[model samples]
Target: MSCSGFQPISLEKPTPEDEELSDKLMEKVRSVGGFDSEETKESKGAVLLKLDQIAKEFTELLSSAMSSTEQVSGECHIKILTSGLHGLGVPTNKPDIDVLFVGSRLVSRLRFFSLFYIMLRRKEGVKDTNAAPDAFVPVIRATVDNVEVDIVFAGFPSKDIIPGTLELRDDNILKGLDMESVRSLNWCRVNAEILHLVPEVDNFRNTLRAILVWAKRRGIYSSCLGFLGRMSYAILVAKICQLYPHALPSDLIKAFFELFSKWKWSWQCPVLLKPSTENWEFGDLAWDPRDNPKDRAHVMPIVYPIHPHINSTFNVTESSLQIMKKEFNEGFKVVSEVHNNEACWSKIFEEFKFFDEFQHFMVVTASAADDGRFRRWVGMVQSKIRNLVNFLEPRNCISSIRVNTEHFSPVSETNKYVRRWFVGLVSQRPLRAKDLRSPIDKFKSMTVLQARRVGFYTEDMKLEAAYVDRHQVEDMRKENSHFGAPTLSNTAAVGTGEQPSTSSVAEKTCQYDETTLPIPPKVRKTE
Candidate 1:
């Protein structure tokens, strides 16, 4: 199961063969859009550096503002909780900075956002700053120099002065805080906790980079759309490291898919490094399915290894969960093939058959007059597409509803930015017009209302819905030649909205799980 000479941190450096494999793996990832290229990484690092500087300046300004206020008795401090600084985040092209403002205990939550908003308005290069004090986790999301920055505020313990080295680990840090503050604190706390749990930093980072990109490409990565978020994926990878502390990136990557794909979800087991000791100490109840019915209802529970151990996959519903499971199974088989020399590593991250999979497709198109308007309009529609999926699941005739993560731009003279997402549909019985009408109408109404509620409704913005046959999809794909391969090479792999199960065929020829690695005691027994 394990590759030789690929020891954890003790190994001086990867051996020649190990290095070759690593380079090959990373290169394969890059080819299939599973990992960022070196150029992309370097560019992202530059942006992050600039973001770090901006965050520092913003913090200083906030501290000055708080100190000037009559309501503040003592000094207020602000710090940018950099994930890269702490080796917590995999290097990514996305510029999402989590900025924490530590203020005096006397300062109110409302005052924090209000003051931050004012400071943002005065600052040059800052735009789209919105302050929602009433939000469950009060945050000020804004763009500085076109990079997204998320700002959260937390106060010092009681009337105590802020320390130069403030660690959120102190039990008193979150004490007497409202739910929103506690939630906000978790952004930093959880990141810190995950970093602490991971044994091999390099192995964890590299393997996670592959998994994260793969998940995103597979379309099962969106947290906003009831799928695994970054934090949840981090927790899962960290747990794998706990089990195999010394495994290299290659071994860990194989083990990652193997372990999760075989995971017994019906048991309702939670993945944890160790039994959670975060109990009523912080006035929060740790997740225990036996006692909390809410915990029992989670379709897929990946418990965070921290206080109040919330299920990071709480947003997952039955439909999304199934989709994720099928994807995991596919990933497991593909990796198995690469290991057996039956296929290249690229096969593991190959694009799935989305539009061409089923006989009929639900084509939902959102068009806008400009790129800016289209981005906002499409984003709102994408976030709420899960609602449409959930609504379709209960109907008896529907086999599966698969959403295309990649949208297409259909031809339109008036529409400057036209993005269309296809929802592949498979029916248990013969397709009937009457059965499809009700769900389509319901989906249309929900999308339209959501667009209007989110202020995306305009004369320039439009929504189009239609059910197209396979021949129509082929014609559309032919029309758009710039898009990648229009069809999967293996026709057998294309069927039923669910990904075709290749593991059964892969198993006949390949011994993917030849190594009998011992499962950890904690992993075997439910807590």
Candidate 2:
């Protein structure tokens, strides 16, 4: 196992004070929903069982449905396996169930996505199926039996084995795999590697659960908006646990904030549970700033432990980096004071006052014609919004930007599918909305331009960023803004009278790249 870190910074046991605090920490952690109950875990497992049956049925149906000319020479075996937090034996409430369909050489990914997608729609309780065959890691996202499931595909070089016979430890498992398949498998591989590398699985999991709750409540949990994700947080906690292998969960959590609050981060420094070098690596370039200049540009590199090591925090930007550092420093003070009996553990998990953090706020809104379209549109907007932050950084009038990672759905918008993301901004005094117009406009245009280039842009999709002041934000609070817009109309809202800006443009046809379009698959049913 590659769980050994660079070196043990300290192997000290927890002091009496830390142990005493731990008792309270565990209580507080449970109270704040840090861990899931037995009932919830069982419920999630049941849902996975249903998905497994559905997937197996789809595979059988696919064999009989495909043309003989298109079929492979041998039998196909497929296994549906779980990964991510649930796979790690620690899960949060409303967790997205991540699974992979591991197939023998006979099954291709194209068939898996298309046929299974069709199969899902035919099943009862399977809805909201969206296929992004051309995504960074192609996936068929769907909600099965009321549980969100992300299904990706990977094919073995030879015939797939029986369920429980395939082991990831064998380095030869990676040979001859396509890049997309390798990336898809990395999610499961890294999760397993982390479990192997941790000194104490229970303590590591407890610390991870507690830290995740704290990060989410503190508004620094999302990977989409340039902050540490669940896996990054896992790798980080595993590294810390390795350093203090003898400590309890309480002490490890304490050490986490204390060490990282003042951590000296640079291009050369990255948080790795195992060393960066691995023998299982495919030929793809790993995250080596010394060798690849582009890798050095990442602000917060939490290296994933697998072949072809990647920076989990590659999306992190300078402003987001500053925001996280500030949170860490504050967290250090809170955690340190707990040891001194000056503060309590509950104080550490307090919710981040995002709405009250700034003078001016920008409400980024996305509206589309349907739920599927809205979900797809929202994903595109969230991915590109970080670039908008990067663009605003060069402006002299703005000092900082804080994106609230949570998104909301409009409570009363019957006309369209709408979602809103609020951004907290710190302005350099003498604020003026007109000054932000050009940059805000650029952000909107860039979003649409990307949607166009990706061939997903549609006329019904609307993106807007309206600049509003503190007083106007209060009005929104009274209107129940957190859940969603109180009364969003197809028209617009006027008042604070802050005049929330509406972004729109003349409709134009998208110039889709003909070569990149996914071919629609045709299936023939057989009795």
Candidate 3:
């Protein structure tokens, strides 16, 4: 399907005045520092520094508190995830710092509870030690350079399958640390690749910026599962990438759908299904699956609801879902059209077949989604799309259309002939500009090279027509201003001197113009 709806709008090219504005914007960037430089840190700088300070202080305080506790054993290891240790390449006004604590067995559990309780406690002073519960672990709040900090702890299993000491070994925690770092690095690399591959960086950036804002507003920044969140999605993607480095995007999407389906019905507890209701018939309920299937179904199992914290972290409202649907539909349409067309696919593959490897990686990972069979089928289709992208990578042309005072005109006959010849040369074998012949041919042919540049001249005539139409409408409105004279058909209030307002005769004149506005085309639905 052709994008006929996207008729090129005739717009005037940037004039000298517009050039001045562009220059000013560029200058502002320079004055602040380059885009990638630290000088232009903006609000992100303050946030990062604050987070770093908070992490250090929190780590130290937790270590000191654990060391003092007689019940605790081993050391503590605290690692800050996200942009706290290394920036994720995006400018953030206030980015969350995810910290993971790997440490002693008993101490880790106690510290985790104590840290959470102390942070939530309403009292200012410490209570009697004897009155504290056996599980109570004291946590002292200390400022490290004035930045606020929060610490959470988790225990690592020892070789004997028992809980380890509070002092977490580097070897035990390395895998998780590496996983987070690798994911962050991959995210940066993927975005950079996108900028390199996509012609319209500004358009892409604008869409991403809008999505980011919407996600933040909805509190769905993380793709964590259980709740509708983005962090879980990201983590899933990262895990897939780790497993299948060459998986295609389509494979990942299909896998996600499959997982969603499986997660929907895997845990079928009636109580979980009905969270609002309470069951208080007995203090404790015993389950005998054979005799009491219904009761068994209501039993709460460990990890019954996977990643329960996700629900609290993300807020996926109806509006957010609608926005995502719109964007996804647009992208799906564009990609599908390019993939299904044999000619386009062949062109893309002719230049870049290696991209298929990436697709394969994505598909492989997606196949691992909860519903294996369904996910596998989805992965297969995604692989096909990736192959299509590879096929069209070369022939696709992108050019900026310009509208000037000059009327529409084709390139000179000689330039056209040269373009056809160059196209033939490149068509035989994919070649960059360095391999091409004739400097003049290459220079002049840029307008018609692989991408054709189409130009139109409607600035003068179109503006004049629009101005005339607008003025005519204004004049007609003025002439009719007094045509509709208002007279009181019924009067509820009248002054003593007012003649009963003449149950006045009123003439309401309505004007109709036979102007037809353009109707937008209907959007197509995906099967």
Candidate 4:
């Protein structure tokens, strides 16, 4: 039987050229650090172990405290299960490891946010700890063993203890859970389902890896900033693998772009691994564009392959959808040519040239008082860059928002706390400074409110946006030449390990404030 959303498109196997292309794609992806090294694997494993240890310690302490405070019948364990790419076994060279703390009914959210968060903050190996208990999906973001880790919480209402053997695949696990827990638990559950539904897990991973590298290089991978996310990319590739069950990675890659490039990504054509079977009680949370205007409005809706079935690409915007479509069509052209000759793989995986492409540009600069505030301030700035893109996208003048997801330090930047992001504001007609006044002003205002909500805003923390042309962009790029490759900040780990910036539902949690591009002053204007 076919494992895809529909029957197999074709059982035809890949030709010799497909094998060659797959091999080349794998090499290119690996060269750009798309896949993990042995050392990275070891480091990531160590971080997971340290995280588990912390969760166990916190649970033990909580169990003791609860026993003393009240009459507890049985001891329930809090299990720390790794999620995201790390848990999915398709992690890149530097995956921001995401782990979920599954607790019992006795363990409340207050304790996890307070006790577990504090414990994580003080843990010897953990550093750069931050928490967002008030966010839509509260999480404790930290780093252990030089690898970023975001610890999310989920407690079962029907269980006294979350034993180690408990499987989240069970639908009842989400019963009586708040929306927050449901979202957090879905992190692991969705990844598990993707792996389960794939016809060939290894092939799916390789195909997805190549696509991820390509998407990153093309600057269309960040869900936080109005682009397809890791989950979306994974599901897209997995679907291709399902359609071509026996196809190799090379064939899957070709099919991916070919099918998606032409597919109408509309409400009538959502990419689903399975049908929207409402078996559980959280139908209200499930995605149904007909009932929910917000869901109906999503330009590119990619449904999660599990219960709740939320649009994994919930953050995608019209501008982003158009931008991604362009890339897909071009990718199809390149990958389809692999049979005749070796496709220009280099062109496919080249670093996005923000300074080269487009005429007018929008420069967003995030400035802080000092090193202590710079990272956090920059993160808040990143979270709202998409809003700016969203607003600008609607204008008739702005054709697309070409954002370079990598971080670039300004040249001759003496503030030591300033980082600049360059965005290619593709406008049809010649653009002037005033043309973007309304959107730029609105974007800055949104940033201010978001910063205040996140409580990271201060007098010294500043966000400034400006409109410039390609000439000015070149000037700024040259000024920052000595700064070398983009800065690899902890925030650069865009969950998928591809983009330097992330957006959307990924940031709805604490990760929201920590993801973007700031503008440089070297190219303020051009005559």
Give me the candidate number with maximum TM-score: 2
Each candidate structure's count of clashing pairs: 0, 2, 28, 14
Model 3 lDDT tens row, 1-527: 11111122222243464344334433433333223344334333453455445435444566565455445555544343321212223332222222333343333443433442333232233221110111111112222222222222334433212233222212223233222222222222223323343233442332232223322322223211011222223232332232222323333222222332233221132111112222222112212233444433321121111111011112222222333334334434433443344222112112112112111111111111122222222212221221222222233331110001001112333221110000011123333433222332333233122111111111111110011122333342343212211011101011000100111001000111112211111100100
Q: What TM-score, to 2 decimals, does candidate 1 have?
A: 0.74
Could you tell me how far off, in angstroms, the CA of residue 222 lies in candidate 1 after the best superposition? 1.7
Clashing pairs in 1: none
The models' CA-based lDDT, in order, is 0.60, 0.70, 0.25, 0.71
- Candidate 4, lDDT over the whole model: 0.71
CA-only RMSD, every prediction: 13.6, 7.2, 30.4, 8.5
Deviation of model 2 at 474, angstroms: 2.4
Encode model 1's per-residue lDDT on 1-527: one tens digit a residue: 22112123232344566556667887765565544446655654564566455545544554555455445555444444543212365645454344665665544565455444554645777775554344344556566766555566676547445566667655467777765667667766777777777888877877877787777666666554566766777777887777778766766777788777777663166776556664664332346676767668767777766666766665567877888878888888887777667887666666565655799777777787876556556655655566677777888988787776655776666554877777788888776666667777787787667556534466787776677778888887665424321111010111100111111111111111112312223221210
Residue 27 local lDDT, model 2: 88
- Higher-TM-score candidate of 2 and 4: 2
Stretches off by above 4 angstroms in model 1 are 1-20, 30-72, 83-87, 95-98, 106-108, 128-132, 157-161, 278-288, 365-380, 408-419, 430-433, 440-466, 471-527
List candidate 2 segments past 4 Å from native.
Answer: 1-5, 15-17, 65-72, 160-163, 278-285, 413-416, 480-523
Assess candidate 3 and give its TM-score to the true structure. 0.27
The prediction achieving the highest lDDT against the true structure is: 4
**105-182, model 2: which lDDT tens digit per residue?**
767787676666666766888777766555556666667777766677888766644356556644567788886677
Which candidate, 1 or 2, has the higher TM-score? 2
